[model samples]
Target chain A: MSQPGPDAPSQPLRITVLTDGDTRPPGLERIEAEADVVLAHDEASLRKALPGSQVLLVTDFRTAALEAAWDAADSLAWIHAASAGVDQLMFDALVESDIPVTNAQGIFDRNIAEYVLGMILAFAKDTKQNVRYQQDRRWVHRDTETIEHKQALVVGAGSIGRRIGTLCRAVGMDVVGVARREKPGDETFSAIHAQSDLDTLLPAADYVIIAAPLTDDTQGLFDAGRFKAMSPHARLINIGRGPIVVTDDLVAALDAGEIAGAALDVFETEPLPADHALWGYDNVLISAHMAGDFVGWRDALIEQFAANLARWQRGETLFNPVSKRFGYAPSSQ
Target chain B: MSQPGPDAPSQPLRITVLTDGDTRPPGLERIEAEADVVLAHDEASLRKALPGSQVLLVTDFRTAALEAAWDAADSLAWIHAASAGVDQLMFDALVESDIPVTNAQGIFDRNIAEYVLGMILAFAKDTKQNVRYQQDRRWVHRDTETIEHKQALVVGAGSIGRRIGTLCRAVGMDVVGVARREKPGDETFSAIHAQSDLDTLLPAADYVIIAAPLTDDTQGLFDAGRFKAMSPHARLINIGRGPIVVTDDLVAALDAGEIAGAALDVFETEPLPADHALWGYDNVLISAHMAGDFVGWRDALIEQFAANLARWQRGETLFNPVSKRFGYAPSSQ
Candidate 1:
């Protein structure tokens, strides 16, 4: 990494956040303090701030600014998103430019792992129904099965998946991990199943969790055929992207009793349309994609951006850089 | 604590398990191996078996059997119900009998404690809506709060309540235990609050969990006045007997936004009528009285009974005896 020569002109660092909610992240203050300008979504404001900046801190690339700047970018040199899934922002921004795009990959790993554990506990223990019954003023006592020693299959060996495997191990569950590249280092997993082993793993798992990224190889992965491979008592939980599971296939799986129940938080569309049939099912538990949402999450994202900022300034290889192999290297790392 | 005298006469033991659900706990072979006769809610069979048997195992006391046996002059003296709650059973069968009674008190403490933690996580993390949105094809996103350092008021320092407090402590929560009686030798509690101190403790708690038995003082405990005392951001969870909390007060609390929400798992009634007003409230999480329904529970109970049986066969006082202070005794100790 070469520094600016004595005669070279210094440039104002440009910062773009992938998605900006109502409150700006505190990381923005750190960026502003160290640099000259801050550019982010809230479109009009980004447009005004864009010309004077040189670095962009984005959590996603779907911003209209990124779309508009795809072919016209001149001053923007470095772009980073504050999330694991950079596919939405990185593909269009990165394939076209030599500028490096870093993502906040490791931030959500443990958090999302906790989310998966929460959903699994809810489903296996029949937790939500207990809440529903008390509302009816009924005291119906019944036996429910716990998760101890149950067979579980994790579809991804990424950071979140590995963390979930560790937590599952703590609860005395038998776990297997699946991935594109076989890794022998995962001692927490009973065995690392390859992508081709998914079919073999499906029938044996009492619970199947989707934690993999959505790639061409992974997209539309759990369709009708895969759903049929599951046992009627088996349950499916998707913490990854929505398209990774074909919605109709899941509905059919539930309908045919190929699976006992589903706890889904990610879907193809959100604020879901009023007339969705999956809403009518008894065995399904739908949550707004809030598993990884905790109050202090803003601080986590801020820390990620702060670290990436240091890396960008030093011109060093950043943590969670988009993998060169995947065209869109997004992660819930 | 003396063993049976050499001159003592031995006779067949009669076991009557008066439970709601139509099932048997595992390892019934042990009971059959020792008991000369078994009675399971069959009035004629129980009548026949009761006259000669010396011991009775009352399975949670079905009311009809209690009514029929009150007048019977049976040799049976001791009765044991496989439950922690003994209010209704005590009222019906043990008020005048010289027979001793015991209960399955400590068996469910850990499991129910785990259930309380499950509810807390569900309430704070929004597992309810997570299940709802997945079916609607929505990837809903929102910030959620955690219980890391929040204050929890556990309004029962009995076995189940203490276990809940322990689990909460493990999660880094500030725990306060409240009960009718606070013994000096009871070091399990970090801080003790009397029943009268509930109001003083309510405002500081992010969660108010009711795990108290239904006593004269505890019945209708969380009436409107108590709900009003809680913080607006607080959540109320009841895993104790239903009458302990006045249902109408809960509704009013939720309606007025006096508290964030509630998770209830028990009620005064069974099979709550479909039209109950409590069912209409969206903020309430209702579960049938099923906090003790985890898998392997039957086996665990059977093992407990077998150990207790060995003690009972000898002339030792039972481990979970009903309070003799009240002057009434169960016939199946």
Candidate 2:
């Protein structure tokens, strides 16, 4: 795994994408046909074919065989992961290498933010319960509420958070952004409050949305103290990393009526345990961290990588390059 | 229904709220505590209650009780409906009379728009399915589509539609607004198109959101012809009245794969009939018309009404008074 790609190919540099049983996107097959394209399910064959490959696109994450294949790849120059929140891709060994890594970031920001808002509205409007009742054919007429003219304290003002805040603000909700560090004169928001303002914002906000990237500062940010500060009628929606919110603390908060309701997309554990209290709770909406799922997902990621490839070929910077300041260096995690 | 109140000892105006329930906002109790407030449930009760009542706050359209209430009320000086759509409240009886009618408009406009965006996101990214799958303890991971850079077409470029357009634009979507009559030099929209231009926009849009009122022009606007013109991948979300999109046409569209998905909050039939095929489709997300549901709803509505009430007392016009184009007075419907 110590060599670079062939100095130059007769055609464009060949790119091999090992995805989860999904075909190459519409235009990608044509691109691959022009280059030395190889599709593989297992890592051994992909690695065997990797010496000629300049780009390796991964759709799935963290398989032992894939790791083994990566270990043997002699000419794998760079890896393009087709997922947001590439924490799973950043193992010790991979980060210890100088290989530049890129992810589909802005691609999923608005989509995921919309997903969070969807769950909030769905739960608040008793959409599922109403559907169940409608299935039973009940004319159970009830007055509904709305998310207008209410305060929304959005934690983690990243790309997704900015989009979420803008959308929420357009809908008449007062948007307050909270980040690790405050930016200067950022008044597009009512105020760009830092993490310290959580106490003041928590109690006042009708909705608290978590959309920050997972970091040391963000881990366990939504715990008992934060939840308690929220009004009993307030709601919490987290699309960020699961550990950013302490699940046990959230459960206690919900149990004690510290907050009105909560929705979880990402969990501290994947495929949350069968006995997890979150599944049975009436107010809580639980999703399997699949807020980023869609019909043309692979195609979208491929399109992004394809664009980045053009940028790379033209000696231009990538579209969504994660900055080194976020504790992500090429050779260090 | 008619009685002299001890508290409102001035020229007492008996106010009857012709609602299913809970038209009471925060400051509503003060009016109830002062004036003779009556809850009219059935047509007979409403008829009996309206004789001496001055104001009727109607919240439901379940029965012909409103007609009866209007018929029996000799001194019916004013009426207010708790919903934005005042069609059910304004008819031959209330329209012909000199009664002043008002509605809760501009209140839920943006919030409802946000809900439409949320529903769009939900369908585009499969949020609810993920939630259900998570509950079943599935770790199934899949690629999701992105909403960024999509083209959205908003129908009925009023307050709600405009808000929905802006919200969509904020998420990097190119949004076009459609209305009955295009307002000249409307800076709120990127491209203001006539309602007739829907056919051209329908095929280009990834999302078609209906936030228009249930007017004669808009009723059954999204019928079969319109549905057929839409791309099979595009989603249709109706925060407008259900009748706007023929429910049967929508069902046919969904079953025949004319469109990708739909999130119908309002229905042609409220508490959408038990055996409706709309509920049976996996792709269709039935929201029981609760896109406007959120916490702090009552307080928000009340505050708006309070401000309007003060304006009314000061002999000033209200903020969201319905247009008197149909030879009907502005009755609070």
Worst 10-residue lDDT window, candidate 2 chain B: B324-333
Best by DockQ: 2
**Can you give the DockQ of every candidate in the order shown?**
0.36, 0.37
Minimum summed lDDT over a 10-residue window in model 1 chain A is located at A1-10
| C-alpha positional error of residue B294 in candidate 2 after TM-score superposition, expressed in Å | 5.0
How much is the lDDT of residue B98 in candidate 1?
Answer: 65
lDDT of predicted model 2: 0.70
Query: Interface Cα RMSD for candidate 1?
Result: 3.6
